[model samples]
Target chain A: MSVLPLVALVGNPNAGKSALFNALTGARQKLGNYPGVTVERKAGRLALADGRPVELVDLPGTYSLNAASPDEQVTRDVVMGRQAGERRPDALVIVVDASNLDNHLRFALELIALGLPTIVALNMVDLATRDGLELDAAVLARELGVPVIATVAVRKRGLDHLREELGGLLDSAAPEAKTLPPERDFDAVRGEARRIARAAVVRETPSRRLTAAVDRVALHPVFGLLLLLGLLFVMFQAVYAWSEAPIAMIEGLAEAAATAARDALPDGMLRSFLVDGVINGVGSVVVFLPQILILFFFILMLEATGYMVRAAFLMDGIMAKVGLSGRAFIPLLSSFACAIPGIMATRTIADPKDRLTTILIAPLMTCSARLPVYAVIIGAFIPARDVLPGVGLQGFVLFCLYVAGIIGAMLVALILRMTVTKGASGGFLMEMPKYQWPRPQDILLGLWQRAVIFLKRAGTIIFTSTVILWVLLSYPKPPEGSAVSQVDYSIAGRIAGGLNVILEPIGFNRDISLALIPAMAAREVAVSALATVYSIDAGDDEALLERSLGDRLKDQWPLPTALAFLAWFIFAPQCISTIAVTRRETNGWKWPMFMLGYLFVLAYVAAGLTFWTATALGLS
Target chain B: MRLTELPLRQPAFVDLIDWSVLSPSEGQRLREFGLCEGASVEALHHGGLWGKGPIACKVGRMTIAMRRNHAAAVTVRTGPDAAP
Candidate 1:
């Protein structure tokens, strides 16, 4: 019953549907590829040529109305007017890749058969011409009995003509189902589509097919994998190397702001709230923005070039051996950067069980959030001197922590596939899209959106949690001038006192317990929480005050506690944002709760084991 | 012979398929990839770090990546090009 004349842009996967939608309607919602990179429906407002505003939706790409995956199901449902929460679209713009006409035409034909007001958008006509093929839009329009608009969505060609056609169609009366073609099987429609495509093409010539030439090496057994590996190495290296200056810059600004607030405000809870809770808590997260953006830039760019799919193809064998799908590879790799997007990326996974398994194991990857915890602990305990000639002991242990997460994830995936999420790995089946240089605008747009989301989380989830944590640490102040620490009188401190009883068996002290609770807000928060606790404990002791957080920890914390805590972080679902995203993606409390439950158990056992082993070995 | 057994770059017709053995989604994918009976297919590439892995096949104008297991269920006749 919604009024804005709804127009749904539909097409086969990689048919330039999304690009066209972006061109016609300024982007609104996001998708992952079901959204694999996205599945969510993206809707926007498009003003027709006559200044008539209409609602436009970009549905998930589908091969045909016969939906194969949940993503395709949305397309099918929306188009057929069966999708809940959406009105039947008033008109359909069936987008087809001009170069791959035969395959794309099949889906277009199926949609056209639905008998709604429809037009064919011969998208990517420029690519087709480049590939040495000429498309006759008139012939196509005549044959299909609908307007055929040749569009280069990326370049915004034929968009005005497209909008004109849409305006005219929507201005006219609602078309009845009089044009509904007779029910046909898959082959019948596809064969007819081939005939129509053959008729529409005016010329064809043999050109060097770039995709095939690239695949010769990209899909090669040895070189393709090596290339993929090289690309991944470069991506990780860039994330670490390129992000340092931006992080430091963000940190410096936060410090300056905090200093200004401290100087301007009278010293009290207000100053502490502004300095510690608002500025420092939020600033800690904003600092990681550079890393997140850097990681997403590489993922988005690779995805745009269509190499991401090929990466999955190359990794299928190894991934299959572990009882998971190849599609799981990208998400798992994404987890190393941050588990939030990684879990969101699992929407691309088709199988219910396969997606569930990927979600469950995604957090087990050593996200950058855990890097601070590891860096702090390792700097305090592990020696920087080389264990081997060139391999520093600290770096080696860091490497081992990453390796441990991977091995743990693999074992857990194997076990889950056999138990809770038991199912045959949904065999990886995907269309290898044609390679094209990603437009700079698209890459920038994607990165901008990602940065916005990351910042938004800092504002909402991190903001609320930081305030609550600050409140917990502040209230119930110490009795007047007793030599007692303020934290010892606080509610959070008492909670940690109780938690220490449970964490004690694994070598954790009261301060470690205090830090672990806030660390659940984010893994990196553990470092600051530890620093805060130590500084509070320092309390007028000038020697303790001058020492760095790491140095203080080095003196008081045993090697076993440090080792056990590192082991705990490797498995713990420490980041609230990851759990929140898990809840959103899975659409219920069931999965996120399951994720938290299992991860807590794993963290406990891992810490206990590491504690017992290190203690017994007399490392203490 | 099964589609996996076809020699690389050799155009073949999908002669028969055991739909029962393949999952619903797998069959749907094959259909979407245009690997139906009598469709001309050429095994373009073998993916993964090993020989036994997913197969990249040219089905019509599109290239589809599928696992060896799914490819094994598809029977094909490799000879002169034939329309299904």
Candidate 2:
């Protein structure tokens, strides 16, 4: 079997490089971290028109070979074949936006100077033509001494021509390696790019006026800020409102499956494991999938429309005041979905101090993993009555929890910036791509990718952990004559009994302490852990196991305890993956350890305060 | 006048950049973003609640937000007769 030729897709940010990669790769893709950094390494399989298979690597977007941020460094390293454990790419596919040829041609020239077999993918030609730009691909190809193929990545137009050209290149001998000239004067490069662009592109009409009109309002100080906040408010509300029916259906399905398993399997350890452990435990966490998807839907739409960059511009002042650049906004906002990606996104922050500070506070930004815990608690305690004519009381509590997390993260960022990571904030110079209506296909693909990742985590890690937790709570057969339940005699119960000494002050009971141990792996697992623990404690009461976990939680735990648990989750460094990512990103245990220590202290103090205050208010 | 002091939406031509006020890399980055001498610039918006924060400027086709101190390093000629 001949080794497949490696093709790298490279371009500047917002060049539709990802759209092209997705169009080419479809479902045949793999995503992982780069050799040492947390920046994602995405590669996919592409079968050419001539029946030749090629490996396509989607390199991180970069403006130049002069790497400033870690993301750009990864791109440069991969292109130079200097990245560890990565082979040199055989061919380079430079995806350039046709509407903005001059802006993109500079980077294309840099890649061309590397002397690789290169193909220029003139992406978004549809948008370019609509904007009254006439681009001659043949002229561009001749000028750059490379094949130029017009492509509309979103519509999959001209992909066949792109593949055919790539196939022809793959069949030929590898191009001789060449290095860029030692002279790094970008002015010359810019001049050459302009010269080439002038010959290849003709602007029939000015493209900036329409975009400028939109920016007049979208970038307005008062109106833009209000619009951004309104968008965010709608997103949070939609996560609850749009997902309610689907969540209830998922919960019903989980309960029905658990009951069916209970009836099909005879009374034994296998039955208990399948019904009580797997279905009840993992099901509780899986039920929150709809909420996670709805949240990502809004995020993906925002990203697709290019408003995310404008958001960073809007928040730049506040972020700068807190000693961070506007670049930190994207990472922190992404943290609302998950901290691991949020931390990885920080690679775009040029300054080491700013990046590190951003990573430290990322976990406090209300990740989707916390949604299950929050949903269950809010569903149980917070009444269903509307705070206003339209907003439910439960959703309002959830929004408050999210706001609390953001506040906690901002305060921590300020402290870290002022102290350990102290340094002048870096530049906030970033491209604000023109807005376009989000393509349904692109948004669907993004949502699908997020759903797969979440379900995979639920099926594997959550499934395995739940089984292990079941054993810890189910075994060591209580003395046949003993009045105490089997859970009381189990190893997990013993451990929780000991840990309760510390947890008790925070209003965490023995069962809650038991859940906390497994919750360390993933925050959402706490809900499932509690479900399994309570189901086991119910002892032969199958009906209790089938009941809604929220109802069970409300009956078992007091108001103060539930509120304290929510408080702890807001600040707790519960996700082990986040900690692991922190270690990898910082390249040491020092920062991760410090993060864990501070978060632990914060979680404890906050939970204790909440518990005490609620008790004082007679909420208990 | 400093680019920071330029009126919003008024076009200006950059005359000089006080590179000494900024770190070498930062100055290089600013130039990379097309804020070099002879580049046309317009202050698009001022950020923050009091509108005295980072200034969003159009340097060529790119929209960039820079701190006041950073913007202060670049001198821009704002007269109607200033060269394009």
Candidate 3:
């Protein structure tokens, strides 16, 4: 058997490192956490030209080897053989964005200085050509004392040649390819790189005149801010515009499935469980997947296009006012999709206090999981009447809810910044990369991954939770000749009813109280829980369940109480995954517990205030 | 001083080398881009549209942005001022 060689991939952000990894490894890859940290590590094996395998480790992206962040530190540790019990790869595939080679080479130069057997993988060559830039690969390789390979990783253009070259290098195992001169040889290498770079790399045109011209207008205080807001408005509108058909289709299919199950099963516990408990509970949340996917698609596009950096830059002043850096904006923006990623992104912020502040406020961003509950309640009660001449009242209310989250996060960040620090605040500094049109392939890749994750969560957490909630609300039939509904005798109802006294302050009745239990699994599960509870007798009819909710709230519960319930759902920080992630990220129960405590206080206070104000106004 | 104090369109030599070796902050940015101490680099242009324009250099790989304030720090050493 031939000896297998090892290859490592390294790059700065947006350098197509992962694309190259995918091209090399195909579908064979595994994701694992880097020892103790939550930073993901991906590794795979690629067969060489000689049929021997080459192990590939795709290192986390970092700007430089200075290693300020944990992700960067991992890269530095692994490359330097400082990671205990980890074997350093034989050769480093230094991926550089061909369009932004100059900015990227600073890191590349550092990697070259590390004296590893290194090959420069100049990625995005096609994009570079489109920009009218050219690189002399041979001359560049001569300059750096390493082979240079131009690759369009997205297209799988250079993999064959790359494999061939690497296989030959490994087969030869040339002593020169395997060793560095000395321990302190970096200064000489750096000097040599400068001399060679000056000779090899040349600019046909020495200007970013186009970028500057665009930025001048876009970064203007007055117009830039307006443009940013306009961009966001368009994104939200697209979410609504594009997702409507898909959502309706899914909803229709679910209703149909429920109907079919009802007809197929005999009128008994089996029929009730299948139709009401299982189908209704899971179906309610599953139908909202389209809107969630649409929202994530736009988010991923904006991120890839580098427009998010501009948004962060524009928001820097506002963030600074609240004692946070522009860096917090990245995580906060990510939090708009989900708090887990938003918390994970806090690693970018250097200051501990600022990182913590960002993490604490992340859940307040109103993730997509809450959208189902919001949509259901708003659709049912919130008047469709427009306040403006042409604007939608429903959309306006949704906008206000989003605004409330932003304001709440800022308020908390401000309070924490003042209290935690003795008037010393963390400063935000960041690189503002030139904006480019988002690559369609990259955007699609990101969107596909996000959609898969949402589907996976829906399949596992929502599916299983719905079934469990269904069983809890279905089994142990009420006694013979019982006047009350079967659900009234179910375990879920009894538990929720028992808790209603304490929840009475927020105007939660037995049904609402019971819904909150499954909601801990996911905020959206509350809708399914409600559906399950209502459909216990209605069987598989979704339309009937929807009407039942409307009727139950309108007849049994006052408008003020419903409004209070809405307020509670909006402000209550539920979701076990979120709290558990917080615990993991913060590395303790302290912050998660603190988060739950304060959010509950806020939820109750908000609900109570809404109830009182609505009652005072005599709305119901 | 800061790069903001340097006069625009001036040809100045950076005195310091190995800028990437500095703190991963803005200070390191100046050094890494060959704007180090005693190295000759010129800011060829300023803002055309954006409030801050991309400064093209006669020196390194990356073009660093020069806000109006920092563009004044680089002292020119051309013609009579050129050190032999």
Candidate 4:
């Protein structure tokens, strides 16, 4: 009986290694955490030459063998068997982008010296040909002494050939490749790459047309900036316009379900919990799914089309003004989608100080999940109408909120850069791929996956929290002889009233104060919590809360106070996930605590300023 | 002539140098296109209005923006036009 061999897949970003992993493993793959770390480890079983099962490990993408970030450290550790409980891969598969072999081969050459039995898969051959690149696979195979298979992972072409080559490697008695000599490492390998390219590579025909078109538009200073802004405007409009109907339908369904559940059940705590607590709490929060999906859809499309890489180019000047390099923009952009991945993306920034600075500021970017809370509040209080002909007042307000987040993030980043980690700029290097239309299937799959995740959270965390909130606010039967409401007697209301003392300066009443506790599950949960609390008070409420709030707020809190509350949530650092991820990324609680403390101070100051000014203006 | 003085549409092959040495917001782009010191490339096309768009040049297998400063760095001898 023969033991199955272990194989590792490695490459630079956009080299199609992940696509190849999907093609090879199909349904046999499983994703899991690597020991204690949050970095994902994927393993799959594949049939080798002798009909034996082999395990394939797909490693994270990296530029070179020289490790910088934690993710890159993982790649080096796994390959060299330095990781605890993780074995070294028996063989290596170096995926190369055929269109831009120069840069890809630079990394490949370094990997070739790692002394593993290796094979090369030249991916995106069609792209290479379309762009007039010519790579002689036969010559490359001879030079590298490894089987070079041309593959188009997206089209599923060359799988059979890849499989056959893998079989040959599994069976052959070819000696393992020689490792780099003790004195020589990356610098040596880079030197060898230059020598090899100079000897063998030559441009048969220069690529001119497509690049000319792109350069003319993108390299022009003023025009490029305008195009970038236009693209951003369109993205924001799509987030609102595309997701509107779905949001309305979701809201309608939730309300109708609450009414049905309320009418069917007896007038008791169980019915209230179901109607006002769980259904109202979770449903209102989940309604933001369409908006979040629309936001991510545009982001992923920008990423896939390679324009995002260009935006880094476009943002360098702006970032420099804030004491960050253009490289920081990638992580910042990632934060706008989700801060977890954004923190992880900071690994690409190279410099430890720069990475830390970017991590500290990442959460300040407004994520899509925050949109529902903003939308509900803004729609209720901000007043939607045509500010001018064809200009949406609500849309303008939304834009301002986004701008506020950006400005806040920049301010924090500037402070961090000037005070904590003043240093020299790191070397910035990135590969910009040829521009192409984004793949539709990839976009659909991405959107569907996110939607499913959001719905799952709704079914679990949001649902449980809502039901519990309902129960706490509904119990003790309101002491039938008493004049006060049941909720005023319940645990939730008592807790809120107790907490109101601390929040008094911020002008939060008991109901607003009560909402903050459950909002820890997510920032958006505050809106749903408020909806649940108010729905309980109103008892299967007639008019929407916005209208009621408009009147109630005018009478009680005043406009400045209302604006202050909005500003508090905007900068409060209320997200638990952001805190958790920050801890995990920094490998400590220090940064997360610092983040929370500063954001709270900022929120308090902003709210205080707003409240005082409004009172002074006699708006209350 | 110095590379920067090369007339419009003149084909040139040159080594890419430091991008920051050229201009701000400019280096980010050259880096994006995989053009850095010691990377060999040729500017094969040019001419476009600023803000309207970038002037294009062939680099590797892709067409890329060839800013005036960047064009100045690359020295080339006339060859058969590689323009499509």
Q: Candidate 1, which segments miss by more than 4 Å at Cα?
A: A1-3, A27-39, A50-52, A177-182, A334-350, A367-401, A423-425, A519-563, A574-594, A608-620, B81-84
In candidate 2, chain A reaches a TM of: 0.96
lDDT of 3 by residue, A334-426 (tens): 887888888888988777787888888888887888888877776677777767765567767777777777888898888878875335555
In candidate 2, what are the lDDT values of residues A229-322, reduced to their tens digit? 8898888888889998998899889878977888898888998888779988999999999999999888888888888888898898888878
Q: Model 3 misses residue A582 by how many Å? A: 2.2
Candidate 2 segments exceeding 4 Å error = A179-184, B78-81
Q: Kindly list the per-residue Cα lDDT of model 1 for residues A47-141, writing each as its tens digit.
A: 98989888888888878776755677778877887777777899999999999988888888888878899989999898888889998999999
Model 1: lDDT of residue A66: 69
- Per-residue lDDT, model 1, residue B53, is 81
**Candidate 4 docking band:** incorrect
Report per-candidate TM-score of chain A alone.
0.87, 0.96, 0.90, 0.89
Which ten residues in a row are the worst by lDDT in model 2 chain B?
A: B25-34
Q: Which scores greater on TM-score, model 3 or model 4?
A: 3
CA error at residue A536 for candidate 2, angstroms: 0.6
CA lDDT, candidate 2, residue A600: 96
Find the 10 residues in a row with the least total lDDT in model 4 chain A: A545-554
- TM-score for each of the candidates: 0.88, 0.96, 0.86, 0.84
Q: Model 1 over residues B1-84: C-alpha lDDT tens digits?
A: 998888998878888888987778778777887878877788999876557889999887788888888889888887554555
Clashing pairs in 2: none
lDDT tens readout by residue for model 2, B11-41: 8999998999887667767766667777789
